[model samples]
Target: MTSQSESTEPSSALHDEQAPVKRVRVAAWAADPLTLNGLTQALMGRLDVFVAAGELPADVDVLVVAADRVTSEVMVSMRRAAAQCSAPMVLVTNELDRTRLLGAVECRVVAVLHRSAATEERLISTIDVVAGGGGLLPPNLLGDLLRQVQNLQEEVLTPRGLNTSGLTSREVDVIRLLAEGCDTEEIATRMCYSERTVKNVIYAMTSRFNLRNRPQLVAYAMRTGII
Candidate 1:
C-alpha cells in the first residue's frame, strides 16, 4: 500500500520550535516549466527561503525537484544538482520506481513528497529537514531501501568476513595507527596489546588483501576510505 505524504514525513516534534535564524537558499526544477514555476513561486513566498533563479547557484542549500514520476532524466537532473552545488534534494513526484530509488538517493535526494501531497507547508517542512541534514522517504520506498541494505550485508559483506566498514575493528585500529605513522610497538602500546598482536593484525590484513608491505597497506586503507 502507498503512504500518505504527511503520514510518511519524519516527525518534526523533535525540532526546536524557535523561529528560523537564517535564510535557506533553494532551487526548484521540473521537466515541465509550469511545475517548476509553481514550486519556485511557492518557496519564494516564504520569508526564510531564498529561491534561486536561472541556473542553480553554487551556494544553494537545498534543491526541490517536481516530476510526474522518477525517470532517468530526473536522476540525471539530481546528479547535475549534486555536482553543481552538493545540495540535498527533495523529490515531489506522482510515483517513484523502487528499483532506481537508491540511485536517486546516491545522487543526494534526501526527501520524497508525493505530488498529491506537495503542499506549500509540506514542501517548506521538507526543505527545513533537508537543509538541516535530515532525510525522509515514503514508507513503500523505505522498505525497499532497507531490504537492499540487508541484502548487501548478507550476500556481500558476510562472505568476505567483513562488516559495513569493510574492515574489522582491530584492523581499523591497526590501519589507523599505521596511517598516523605509528610503528607496530607504538600501536600495541596505544591499544594496550602485545606487539605480536599488532603484527598479527597487520599480517592478516596484508595476507588477506595481497598487500606487500606496511606502506601498501596504508595506501589500501586510504584508497578504500578505511582510515
Candidate 2:
C-alpha cells in the first residue's frame, strides 16, 4: 500500500492543478440606479466574477453598461470611459442599430446583448469571452457588422490604397494561410519565398498589431472579417 504521505502528495498536487483562475473584475454602470443594481444582483455569487464600484476601475477586465438605447450622447460617454481604460466592454441594451453598433465598435465595445435576452448565464459567458480577448455578437448582428465593414472598405479604404482591415495584401495572405494551419516552411514553399521571409512577415504583422502570437493574429483577422 502507498504511504500516507505519498497519497497526500498526489492529492495536494491535484488540488493545486484544479485551483480556479483569478476572477474577472467587472464594473457595471447605467443611467438608472435600478438598472445598475439589477445587473450587480444578477452577477452576484458567480464563481469567476467580481463586481466593482466607482467610475470604471483601472484594473477591470470587462465593463458592462446597461442602457435603454445607444444614442450620440451614450457614444460620447462610452468613448470617454473607454479612453480611461483598455478593457473591452459589453453593452446591455434594448436597442441596437447599424450606426449605433458601428459607434460602439469604435469605442472598443466587444459584445452587445438585448436586455430581454440577457440571461445570467449568457451575460457571464459574454463577459468571460470578452475578458479573454475574444469578441461576442449575436448571430443577426454579425451579418450587419460584416456588411458595414465591407461598405467602409469599398468607400474609404480602397480609395486610400489600404486593405479594408488595415492589413497589407501580403500580410493578409500570410495570415490566411496561417489560419489554415500551414507551417512556416509550407507557407514559404507555397509562396515561393524563403522560410526566413515567411517568419519575418509573421513577426512584422504580430509586432505591428501587438498580438501575442500567430493564433491571436488569426483570431483578430477572423473577428474583423479579414479572412
Candidate 3:
C-alpha cells in the first residue's frame, strides 16, 4: 500500500509545474503617438501588460520611458516610480550619448534602447532581462566605451606619469612611458629600477597578453583600459 506522503508528492509537483512565472508590468513613455499605439497593440491582451507612464496602474512592475525630451525631471520621475514600486526602468531613446548613458546607469536604469527598437523582438528581450535584474547595453557601445577608457588613459592618466597597464599599476607605468617614447634606460631611471628590471616588466606584459610590438602593446592597453 502507498503512504500518504507519496499521494501528496504528485499533487505538489503538478502545482509547482503549472505555476505561472510572475508577469512584469511595463509602462510605455513615448512621445510619438504612432509608436506608442503600436506598442500598446503589441502588449494588449497580455497577462503582463503595458500602460502609459502618466497613468500607470498600481500593479506596474517596470517603467519603459520614451527617449523623447528626456531630462533630469523625467529621470527623477522614473526614480520616484521605481522607488515606490521597487520596479526597474527601461529607457527608449533615439540616441544614447555618453553623458545620458552614464546618467542612466547612475539612476539604476535597467535597459536602454533606440526608439527604432520599439518594434524589435530584442526590445522585449531586453525588457525581460532588465526586469530580471540584468544590465543591458547596445550591441556596439562596448567598443566606444573602451575607446573612451583608452582616451582617459592617454590624456589623463599618462600626463600624471601614471600607468595602469599590464593588468597592474607598476607594469602599466613601464608600458605607458614606453609608448610615450621612453626607452628602458629612461623608464628605469624614472621608475627608480634597474634596466634589467624594466626590461623584465616589459617582457612580461608583452608575453602574458600576446602583444607583438610596442605599438600593439599600447593599443592593447587602450583597448582594455589598462593604460
Which candidate number maximizes TM-score?
A: 1
lDDT for residue 142 in candidate 2, whole number 0-100: 88
Candidate-wise lDDT, in order: 0.83, 0.83, 0.70
Q: What TM-score, to 2 decimals, does candidate 3 have?
A: 0.48
Regions of model 3 farther than 4 Å from truth? 1-17, 45-47, 53-59, 68-80, 139-227
Q: Tell me the TM-score of each prediction against the true structure.
A: 0.65, 0.65, 0.48
- Which residue runs does candidate 2 get wrong by more than 4 Å? 1-20, 47-55, 165-227
Per-residue lDDT of model 1, residues 1-227, tens digit only: 65565465556875646775778888777878788778878888773344444567777788888889888887887777777777888889998888887788787887999988888998899998988989989888899998987887899987887776667777888898999999988999999999998999899899989989999999988887887
Instruction: Score candidate 1 by TM-score against the native.
Output: 0.65
Cand. 2 Cα-lDDT: 0.83
- Write one digit per residue (lDDT tens) for candidate 2, span 137-205: 888888999999889899988887679567777788899899989999999988999999999989988
lDDT of 3: 0.70
Which ten residues in a row are the worst by lDDT in model 1?
Answer: 47-56
Whichever of 1 and 3 has more lDDT, that candidate is 1
Steric clashes per prediction: 0, 0, 3
